[model samples]
Target: MVRIAYDPTPYHFNHGVLELPDIVARLGYEYMQLTPHPEFGPFHRMPKADDELVAALKKRAADAGVKIVALQPVQRISWPEEPQREAAVRNFKRVIEITAQLGVDTINTEFSGRPERSEDSEAGFYRSMEELIPVAEKEGVRINIDPHPDDFVEDGLEAWRVIRGLNSKQVGFVYVGSHSFHMGNQAATLLPQVGDRLGAVFAADTYDHHRSNGLRYITNPPGNSVRVHQHQEIGNGDVDWNELFDTLGKIGYLDREDAVIVSNVFGENEDAEGSALRQLDKIRELISGAAR
Candidate 1:
């Protein structure tokens, strides 16, 4: 029963936001998850969508027989700087409003905070959450956080601890397959722990930088710290698709009505449609295999 949503980021540049529904339907997906789009909103910026725009998008999706299952807006709501954090909060409020208007109850986003200033950024994150949780609660929208690379918390278990500290069911976790290694490559361990709080799963492949004794990628300075990953087509990289899906099945994530699986392949833009189709096919295969 897990809902599968297609991310239209690959088509955003060539097609406008208004045209995304048709594009997604053409790709044979019944559900669409709106990622950061310039016309609607971009990363770290306030939303540009108004009431009229929201209405138009809703009608368009309905006409195309596609449902907008979720919205993803990447704002720096956890910025260490006070002014930036304030603006991000304002932007996030609008994001929640849009989600409500679209009849979508899920907002998948990141803890967009500074990694270097971890303490201050963590404080800013909690402050912003304190202010926004009420709004999300009122709107009946759940916020799922991704502990992205360079964020205040990137490890999967630690990020779960941070989200758990909030003590609100309105907040949850996003497990992006591409970030598996950065998140400790412990899907078996993390997914079971996240359990019912795991809001969404993003399907994309990424190489294991820890492979080959860390010589897979090399930088000029030996000691330089950097996180390298990719949103490649499923099975094109190191993620163990069978193991990941099996874990979800074990945790009962694959059987939840609210469970969302998103196809977010971005590495093969030149053949976006092909990648989308393959992701959909693979996701369905995985789900079928995961059925207990």
Candidate 2:
């Protein structure tokens, strides 16, 4: 069975971390992918969590009957600078320690490669992984890295290569539906290419830009240079949900013991709770249909 998880990215800005479990459970979701928060350092660049905070968060989730299946620590580890890179590695080590304490086994993140210096960034990524991989193994945690649009290793094939290079079962790839355009055109083909390294997935939709010729939509001047995409409700965008689910079934993702299918829709909408519940229903229906 494919365990469907709800990610609280939309609520990260408005809701307190302690309140997430209740919201997730109320939406009828059994699992959650905890995002970074200012109070808990968002688990991004070294959380502000000590033993007390970690214990509190874990207890809160347990009390609400929501299992924290994964934690997303959004940090830039591909910095070419030496000191900053070392600090990122250290921060990730702390994140892994927190993951172990919370009894969660997975950490999802972007490769976060530097756009300007691709080669240096790739080297930096490998160097950081060398230090962090052993720590992950020791703590019994899996690292699932994805190919974000502007990251150095943005290509799906390249991301898989990096995961394979790590040469550890604890490392794997995440297929973000919101990044399908940037990942590649053939979702059916690309997904299976990751093969057994496919550990988790970010279930959301994005506006298709394959035919736009780079003239799709403009955010604003002076915005972050990276190309951004939406994490809208599944059927609201161009992601082929039927095809995605069918492909997943063909790959036996639903049967994998460690597979995580997360509903990660984020926007400035008012009814986040309603939106999440709706997405959960859609995901469940698709998974069930695929099984049949």
Candidate 3:
């Protein structure tokens, strides 16, 4: 069955990394996706988690009856600069080791490149992949990439094509619902192309900034590039939930064992508890509706 996981980012400010499993269980989720955290793995740096911390975190999650579905670490693996790319490769290898130690098999991360230097950044990505793909394969871990806004490749299909270029079964793609607009709002087409290689879907909502003749958001400088999106609760934004789920079901992602749907609302942390519960309820409702 497709697993529903929780991204504990809203609670990161208050909760320690080791305490995340209990927090997720309290929110009525059976699985958790560990995002960047200071004690575990911070963004754009080496992982801070030692072996002792890894063992303790594993025990904590087990005791809480919460399974870890994936680990998310944002590294400059696609950096155009050679030094950062090489360091990211080394850190990525260590992340695989940490992932294996925790008994997890999935790592989802961003491309971490610049739009102005896409070609160079893409080359760096390939070089880093050449070194780390073997390590991930040996460790039995799959790496999924999210083409985040402002990165080298923000379009959904293009990102998939870039990932496909790697020619490795272990590399996959992540489709984020909240980024629907920035990615050209083509889930119907993109998800089909992703097919079984689609590793995870992030559940959040955002308004389409491309609407109203590009006046949905008015930048101060009038045409300066700025990525606009939000992590609102499911129904609050413009994401076509039914259509997304239908496409997912059509592509067989709804029934796949390795497929994960993550709740990653970030805009409303003051009422995070309620938002998380609502998101879980809504995800189940959509999944149920899709199944029928």
Backbone clash pairs for candidate 1 read none
**Model 1 local distance difference test score:** 0.94
Model 1, residue 42: distance off in Å is: 1.1
Instruction: Give the lDDT of residue 126 in candidate 2.
Output: 89
Clashing residue pairs in candidate 3 (N, C-alpha, C atoms within 3 angstroms): none
**Candidate 2 least-lDDT 10 residues:** 215-224
State TM-scores per candidate.
0.98, 0.94, 0.98
lDDT by residue (tens digit), candidate 3, 1-292: 7899999999899889999999999999999999999888998889999999999999999999999999999999999998988888888889999999999999998999999999999999999999999999999999999999999999999999999999999999999998999898999899898988999999999998888998989989987978999999999999999999989888899999989999999999999999999999999999988832
Q: Give the Cα-based TM-score of candidate 2 against the true structure.
A: 0.94
Q: Candidate 2 on 90-130: residue-level lDDT in tens?
A: 88999999999999999998887777788898899889898
Total clashes for model 3: 0
Ordered list by lDDT, greatest first: 1, 3, 2
| Model 2 regions lying over 4 Å from their true place | 218-226
